[model samples]
Target: MVSSRERIKAFDKKLLKSGEYSVILSRLPAYIFELLLIVIATSGDKLSEMDVFIVMYAWGLTFYIAPYLNIWENRKNVSIYEVLKSLPVNQWDIFKVRVEYIAKLLLSRFLIMLGLQIPGFMMTGKILKENMINSLAAIGWAALVLTIYALPGISNYRSNKQIKWKAKQGGIMWKKM
Candidate 1:
């Protein structure tokens, strides 16, 4: 049988070539066009480069995560019973594939931000600009891995703490990572 990892790589390669992906990628062009318009519209006036970075960050945040969030939201409409009836290998395979896609999207966004930051830094220089990009780069790789691994248990970790607190009339225990 073909492995789930292979399936996901194939799917991503397909998606990268698809028109929908083209549309998604075109968002950057639209963003750049809008920024040009902003500059043109304010041609007589002075503006902060900070303002441009702020707008770019806000817009890119939406575009960066929209596709993954859409996938998660669609899962809400799926029938749990129907899914449960699927074969174990298929289920495991598909689950892994979805995780891979989500992971890839996250990594892609991180790299895109890092890629964009260099140009912005060139434009803004270190003295006037806040150093978010440099700071983000310092931690981005490790944070990405932790964020993915943290997803499986982060909420429950909080919930478990609450549960322990509520039951502390008997006793309490703590485990360190």
Candidate 2:
């Protein structure tokens, strides 16, 4: 008998496909990478300081927004409120899954980049001096922003569930300041 971990692995192998990643990656800031590669090629053998700045800028632009994509995705294609109000599972599960997916996808992308960067950094250790602290700060700030954006949807879902439950018991839900 396969263990739960094996089952999860099978499920992931089925649901997470290369084509799906291609779509997700396309939605991300691929253009920035393309531009960086072009500049590197034109430089004729090595990247310069400006190349490092460009890479950092690209990451800065994309990193923060990565965590919040779930919220944006939901906003663009909001789950039906009417349907959610009737579901048996707690309303938060839907938001939780979305946020989880975003985190997973972002980490996947980050891992891929880190895999590539480790080799590149090894080759030119000088560029490694770029402020790691700033990148970390950006990540923290972006996560905070993503969480804030998600709050509204999660709150909406929770409020809807509470209201539906109260109505089922013939009680009115009230909002107090």
lDDT of 1 at 125: 55
RMSD of each: 11.8, 10.6
Error (Å) of candidate 2 at residue 151 is 3.1
Let me know the TM-score candidate 1 reaches against the reference structure.
0.36
lDDT of 1 at 162: 49
For each candidate, the alpha-carbon lDDT, in order, equals: 0.42, 0.43
Model 1, position 87, has a per-residue lDDT of 39
Clashing pairs in 2: none
Give a tens-digit lDDT track for model 1, residues 20-106.
654476456436644553443233222233455444443444334233222211112122212233434354454455455546654
lDDT of 2 at 80: 33
Best by lDDT: 2
Give the TM-score of each candidate: 0.36, 0.40
After superposition, the stretches of candidate 1 with alpha carbons farther than 4 Å from their true spots are: 4-76, 79-84, 88-90, 127-177
The alpha-carbon lDDT assigned to residue 45 of candidate 1 equals: 22
